[model samples]
Target: MTIALRRRLLAEFTGTALLVTAVVGSGIMATTLSPDDVGLQLLENSVATAFALGALILIFGPVSGAHLNPVVSVADWFLGRSAGTGLTGRDLAGYVAAQTLGAIGGSILANLMFDLAAVDFAAKDRAAGHLWLGEVVATTGLILLIFALARSGRAPVAPAAVGAYIGAAYWFTSSTSFANPAVTIGRAFTDTFAGISPASVPGFVAAQLVGLAVGICLLTALHPDAGTAADQVVAPTGERDPVLGHRP
Candidate 1:
């Protein structure tokens, strides 16, 4: 691989690993700190996730667009498909693989840090039409927020804005805003407060994909002239790509 592509892949891997570490790690800590108070635990988990996500984006946006989410990467490719100027197919595959592996590795690391068994299958069965709908809503909002910032040339504010949106969605959405497919998969490896069962992953992923489609349609209708997308969800620095920056 070229040096630039390698750097981007490394950024995606490391950024995603850290993001999941914050998420699963905080959830573990929250449960320990507030054994009986689910509300308090959720609050702690959401706040940590929000802050960590924002920070990760800021740290890695310039290097790799800090996608940290497979759906976001896929959306970028799809948006730029007509022009073929955004993430190439190879980049897409590499990014998704790195994110997925990083997610699993993060989960394992979090579990080990808490003295818990690594690769514990999550028992939380987040199944139900309403909860699935919540996933759809959460994912939809996430994608909309991400591309909306890029389309509007407001990429710099994405870190804070996306973080804020996720924090809010945690309370507003039934699924606690597990809007990311890689995250969803990672959570399945841990039987923690933030986890979903493996059986439920497909449904959640399906919902997220549907939400992605909705977000893209909305983005196109809202900003037909939007030429490129941003590297990070909320905050991209440096040059922007026609669909997402092509900065090497």
Candidate 2:
């Protein structure tokens, strides 16, 4: 019941809420504004999501690691257990709960803001082996990017690197890179272009978990002694996040 833990949970909740808000909100706007151009709609949605995510990471990276994603939280916990520098099991539970609830709230907020029903289920059916493959690849790449930066002592670059990778994955992956279980669950509540059907959610989540396993294995193989710093996933406190052409 420390204040720091509370702050971390709050940051995770608020940060995740904003991230999902940008995602579902922008998707709704894109479909409405560019009804005829699917490509353009995707572009708009991806850009908004990318920028919003980077900003959220930069703003909250020092607190709660800005995990925003449950898998990231769990991955950090698992990876840092031996090093004693990651989230405790209790912290993991709190963070996952906050993220999941925040994601749902974000979806509801987006729907309400756009005058849509608060709990309308998505009708977009995104099922298929190939699409699942895309989810696996997308999630795997995401984990790789985060941990890779941490291993190489380049974690300060993670905000931009993660954002850029996701922006690009939206175009490269057939599934548009949902890549996140919390996000996938939240998007199921909306019937917008960004939404996924409830039926498809379980499969997508399973694929993401598989991808997580693969990413963990790859990290161990590549850097068995990777540092257990918080910045492995989110930026640390007081750092500038290296924006404005400082990527490397």
Model 1 clashes, total count: 8
The per-residue C-alpha lDDT of model 2 at residue 149 equals 84
Mind giving the per-residue lDDT tens digits that candidate 2 earns over 33-128? 999999999999999999999999988886667889988887888888888867789999999999998898899999999999999999999989
| Residue runs of model 2 more than 4 Å from their true location after superposition | 1-3, 237-248
Model 2 score (lDDT)? 0.86
**Model 1: how far is 135 from its true place, Å?**
1.1
**How much is 68 displaced in model 1, in angstroms?**
0.4
Cα-based TM-score, every candidate: 0.91, 0.92
> Which portions of model 1 show Cα errors greater than 4 Å?
1-3, 230-234, 237-248
